[model samples]
Every structure is written in C-alpha cells, then in structure tokens.
Target chain A: MDAAIRFHGVGKSFKKKRVLDNISFSIPKGEVYGILGENGAGKSTMLKMMANLCLPDQGGIEVLGQKPSWELYQKIAYLSDRAKWYSDYTVEEALQYGKNFYPDFQMDRAEELVEFFKLDRRLLGKEMSKGQEARLQFLLCFSRDVELMLLDEPFSGIDLITREKMIELIIESIMERKLTLVITTHEIDEVEGLLNRVSFVKDTKIVVEGEVEELRLKSGSLKELYREVYA
Target chain B: METRVVGSYRFILDFSQPIYEQLVQQFRQMLAKGEIELGSKLPSVRDFAVQMKINPSTVVRAYQELERDGLCEKRRGQGTFITSSADQVAGLRREMAENALESFVEVLKILGVTQEEAQKMIAGVEWK
Candidate 1:
C-alpha cells in the first residue's frame, strides 16, 4: 500500500495552545478519506500543514513520499472556509487567476465546472453569496488535476440542493481522476456515502480511525460512533 | 420484505453490511417484485456508483453477485441486463416468499400464537 500522505509524530502549537500533539496517520492513495472532529479539533491546522501553508512544530510530514514544501503545493489543492480571492474579481477572472498560478490547472475543466455549477460570471467575488463563493472555490480546486485535495467544511455555507450537487460532483471527479481526497467535516451523515475511511480526532490526537463500514458496524452509524468517541 | 436500502427508489447504504451485499439483496428483491424488468439494461457500474455516491468497485461486485444469482447477465462491452429466464424468475419468487414466511412464522412463534390461530386470522382478514 502506497500512501499519498504520511504524518509522523506531527505536532503543531499556536503559541501556548497545542492544536495537535504527536498525531500520526497515513492516507492511502486513491481513497476518499474523512478527517472528522468537533470544532477546534485542529482539523484546519492539520490540513494547512498538509498543503504546506504552515509547518508542524515537531516531527515530520510527507506527501507523495517527499517532505511537504511550496513545490509540492502544486500537487495539492486546498479549499478552505475563508478562501481568498480579489473582491472585485469576477468568476471568469478567478479562473484566470487559478490557471495563471497553477500550471496543472485546466481551463476547460474550470469552465465546465463553472457552467455545471451555474455560477454567474458577471457577479463579483464580493457580490456573490456564501453558497456561490463555495462553488467558485470548488471550481478552482477541481480545475487542478492534483493528487491530494484537502477540503475544510465544504458543506457549511452551501444550501441543501447545492450541497447535494457538490457531493455528486465530488464523487464523479474522484472516480474519473482516482484522486486522494482528505476532507474535514462535522457533518458525518452527509458525507458518509462518499467516505472510504474516517478518522476521529480528539484531544489533539486521532482517537479512532478505521474503514467507515467497520466503524459503523462497531457503533451503528458514523454519527453514533462520533458520539461514542466524543461523549 | 427484507429490503436492504434505507430509502425508497433511490439507494442509501447502511453500516451493518458491505455495500455489495446490500446492492445484491436490493437487486434480488427488485427482480422478485418485477420492479426491474427482465431483459432490461441495468445502470452501468459507474452510473450507479455515482448515483449512490459509493465506490464503483462495490457496484461491480454487486453486478457480479447478481450474475452469480442468475438474476442478471452481462453482455461484454454493452452492459448488464436482467436475465431473461422464466425458471430463474419463478425460483426467485419462491425463495422470496419462503424468506418472508420464515420470518413471519418466527415472529408468530415469539408471540406464542398457535398455527391454527394464525390460519384463522389470515382467513378472517380481507385482502384489499
């Protein structure tokens, strides 16, 4: 089993507060992995480290068998809750920005996704709603044919209909590209359908981790298992 | 009567069983009830997987199980189709009825109802 990303004794601290403490896990290649935990569980910090946006305070992390660096960031796509874009940039301009920044970005795919998502190109980044922003962020991420995708709370700002479409599109893209996706979401039941494996993070460590089915068999459902672990 | 999916027409998987087994069972029930017509094309592995938001490999395994059960057959390169066999259909019906009756009788035994009482109840109840 080849690993897409491996974390070895990884620890991160923001000043006095330790966000992650000696956490270690490996995401297998071509798998949809879910990193699940309550808010303030260091899920966002961990994803940041994986994407080379931040460095771990202790221990090592590797992506594609090599240490994480800005160079490797091209192979990894990160979609965060507070994604940055020029306030005045239109949807088409944002696509241009993505293509200019990431050589792996496919303009055709970005256009297709924009059309599929029904994002109004005339709307400015600052003018669109949270749901529309989520769509644009996803469009930018999926435009790049990368190995690893780190998604943080993708379902929060979107409506139910858009969220369903996002889930369906995520599955379609994953199957088509054989991507390695690591998602952090508190909505366990919503994402349960697409997850192959899940890890429950607590107290700055992975409290439990296993295939979704095994976890379910052990504790009824993912939500129940989450309650049992976090209870 | 023992449906595997947690929802209607659309499928939603549960954790108690592997996805392929659930899919196989669901397809078997569908065949027995004539919900899926014999000799009709089944959804492709990718299409079904996408619809269910599950792994395509699981869908493939489900189709394999269907073929093994003689409920469906795959025409290479084209797609899988419900097997056009009258004997197989009749066998499926019998098996489904036996399974339902077996569970029904087990419940009756647990409830301490005698066979004669159950027969009388069945006869007294009007079929609508």
Candidate 2:
C-alpha cells in the first residue's frame, strides 16, 4: 500500500483565478488514477504541480514519497501539452533525445514500441498527424521507467482508432513495468474502463473520489455521476 | 508487444449491478462453458480493463474473486492462469449448473408448473 502521490490541501491560483482549492487525494502505487472533470476544472494545474512545473500557492504535495523537486521530476514522466522538448525530432531521433534526457529511457524498447505501433521512423514529431503524434508521445513517455506517469488529456485530439491503440499500449506498458499512472481527461466515456480509481474535480476541488468499483456501487457509473454533478 | 490484446472481448457495462460482480459472473460462465480452457492464461488486469472499457481496479477485484473461488491462480511474474485441478473445475461446473437449474425451477414455480410439466414441455419443444 505504498503511496505514489499524496496531496494535502494543495491549492493554486492563476492571475486571481483560483484553479485549485485545497485539493487532497492519495494515489497508490501501480494504479491507473483518472483525474476527471469538465473544461477549466484545474486538472492541468494540479498536474503541473506534480511535474514541478508550477509552484502551488498553498498546501503540501508529495510525489513518489518526496516533495516535488527537480530530482523528483527526473523520476516522473509527465505527458502534457506543455512546450515540446523536440517536436522537430523524427520518430527515431525522439528516442535518441529521450535517452539522453532521461537516464531510464529505454531506446531499445522505444524502437520496439514504435515498430509495434507501426509509426514510421521518418515522420518528425511535429509532422505527424495529431493522432500519430499522440501515439508517438505516449510511446516516448512509456519508454522511460518512471515511478509515476502523468497524462493530460491523452485522447483529446486523437481519432477513435488511435485512442484505442493508445489505451492498449498504455495497458501493455503498465502491466510490463507496473507503473503508476495519473491521467487527466474530460472525456469520461473514454477513460471509464482504464482508470483504477477516479476523482471528480469541481469548483476548484475534488468533490468526489474513490476506487472506481466502490464508487460505481455506492453511487453509480462515473459518467452518470459526472453528468449529474456537471449538469 | 504494444498492440497486444491480452484479453479479447468487449465488456458492456451494467449500471444496475456492480461491475466486478458482472465481470466475475461472466468469467465463471466462460469457465463453465469451457470457453476459456483449463490452465489457460487470463488477461492482466489492465488489459482486461481496456478491453472492457472499465476501470482497471474493477478487473483486479474480479480476478481476486476468481482466485478466492479457486477458479484462477496468479503465478509470480508469470500472470494469472485457470485452475489446473480437475476437481476444482468440476466443482465450479456443478455449482454453475445448479445455480442455473435453481433459477429455472424458480421460474417454473412462478409459472404454476411442476417439474413433470416442465419435462413434458421440454419434450414437446420442436427439435428441428
């Protein structure tokens, strides 16, 4: 029952707009946690704090049994819409770059993954279609053996088929590495099955959170509850 | 590797009943029907979750239930496999059949028909 992440009243505000307010939840190791909400639900902001990309205005947050810091960032593979480190890198080059950037990055596995996904080696990260790019991004992220993997809106722009591919690959990687994943998305239907647990963020805080089955049994499906809360 | 389907089948969500219960019941039926052969490898929790489009944790619970029932066993680092013991499979099959028969008898009682009448009705069913 080791905790991969723990947030104690974590709060953040951006330019007078409070994005998060006392958000508290703990994610256990080797679990697929879904951070779910609608648009402007502070999901991204909370993820930024975990990635050490943003400083929380108040409260404490712990990732991988330690405070958020640059060293901790090294152990976290964050997938976000943040600036691409090397969008111009070809599929092959991305692996080379990822290897140099993350010591745990597995170039051999990355090559295998790209081939498995049938992603062309010649296509640059910036040149691939949105779906192709998403698949590449997921492959590159999973190449690193990190304690925690954070995904922000993983299927936002991808097509249905590509999203399915991404989900399959993600599961394969999680099972192989026993990685802890925290994925944020507004699309409830897409992630209902992949998540081990779920936290429904509303009005700048977590209004509901629990293991998916328990919550579904106690209340109802996440989609129905999410609709009721957001409606 | 990447696109591998460790579990093959779509799981349609049933909101009225607990998902893990549904999953366990489905796997049990598959076991009784020999849809999944004895000693076969069951899919990993995450892979089954993706296939069913349900939470991975729920799949874990279902696998745990299967283990509790002596239906499946998880090998360290190898994965979960169906029970190898013949007695265990036979017991499960008998349990499933009895449960089905119980429900059938209950429906017959509600229909105001006896087992004798049910037998005649079964015999009367066209075999074409």
Best by lDDT: 1
lDDT of 1 by residue, B1-128 (tens): 12223223445466555667777887787778877666988887767776676766667778898898888899989998889987898899899999999999999999999999999988999999
lDDT for each residue of candidate 2 in A1-231, tens digit (9 for 90 to 100): 799889998888889999999888899999999999988999988888889999888999888889999999998989986657657789888888889889999888898888877899888877778888888888888888877899998889789988888887777776677789999999876776677788989999899988877787778777888988899
For candidate 2, please provide the TM-score of chain A on its own: 0.96
**Tens-digit lDDT string for candidate 2 (B32-67):** 777777898887776576676555667778899999
Query: Candidate 2, clashing residue pairs?
Result: A193-B53, A193-B54, A193-B55
Quote model 1's TM-score.
0.87
Model 1 DockQ reads 0.46
Enumerate the candidates' DockQ scores in order.
Answer: 0.46, 0.40
lDDT of 2: 0.83
lDDT tens readout by residue for model 1, A1-231: 799989999999898999999988999998888999999998888898889999999999998899988899888999997766657899988988898999899999998998899999888988988788888888898989898899998997578877867887787887688789999998875686678888899989999988876765666677778888888
